[model samples]
Target: MRLAWKRWIFSLLAACTILSLHAEDEADLEQPDDVPWEEVKSTLPAYPEAGEWLPFFVTSATTNTFYIDAKSLEGTKDGVMHYTLKVVSENGAVNVTREGMRCSTREQKLYAIGDDRSKTWREPRNNQWVFFKKWAINRQLNVLYDDFFCPGRIIVYNVNDAIRALRSGVPVSGKSSRD
Candidate 1:
């Protein structure tokens, strides 16, 4: 009796498999490899150095240039750090906020950079269009600390993996690491 039952189950499973194969939607299948991909272009920075984490940035940076100012960075969770960038413009008067984007690690450690607003009417005084990255809210990055080290781009991976790379030396670029 047990053997017969086993045989019945196997036959039923085989039938189900055959039926499902025929029932699959065309959309579920992959496109034919012979078909060519559509030609497309963009004007953004591409960060190939950005490790496993799905690279995200303002201006669609990842869509173009991969160059990052390692010198303009601060502490990395392990070897990676989150980041955001803001551009300000000013002539001799007020401060204006320009393009800005916030990029966080998979674990959500924040990162951001602030620059001049480009509008003299809104520009901040006593500072020359200062640009710097803020680690924590109250904690600001030091531009000339000399002790600060910049982490690399190949740090944390995805949301599934939350480990980071640590930096102990100056980054490749000469931009301010902290502001």
Candidate 2:
């Protein structure tokens, strides 16, 4: 009798927890269809002027996901203005925290890296695995200075993993994530 009663209680508790989580998810998804663009325009930090090229962006790739999943940067707007960000998982498995940089030749088009071409980037600096993207730094500055021979950004994923994910196509890309 005790085992049966305990099982019933546990099941009931589990169901309640799941319902609560679902409710929270629904609440998070309340924004309009254009919310992504709105957030990008309003929340994105302004670039500090660089000399020749315009500094476009210097942030973690987690920016998009964090904006979508959490609706805010770590529950605060200030955290959004960062070159580094973290991802927290419910199970804590594939959590990510990395910084990225992207620079642009035009001030109005600084945010075109990854999603666009023509942006100037620095050669990937592989200093014992802690690489840096000069494009990102350029975006946050008032100059268009970079070492072209080393402008390959050290992407967040390894070559194999990147190939696999890229093969997964638009799903891995945020272009389809909003939907």
Tens digit per residue, CA lDDT, model 1, 91-167: 33311121111122112222122233431222233422123332222122222111122222233224112221113
C-alpha lDDT score of every prediction, in listed order? 0.28, 0.25
List candidate 1 stretches off by more than 4 Å.
1-67, 75-105, 118-179
lDDT of 1: 0.28
Per model, state how many residue pairs clash: 36, 20
| Model 1 Cα shift for residue 24 (angstroms) | 23
The Cα RMSD of model 1 versus the native structure comes to 24.4
Best by TM-score: 1
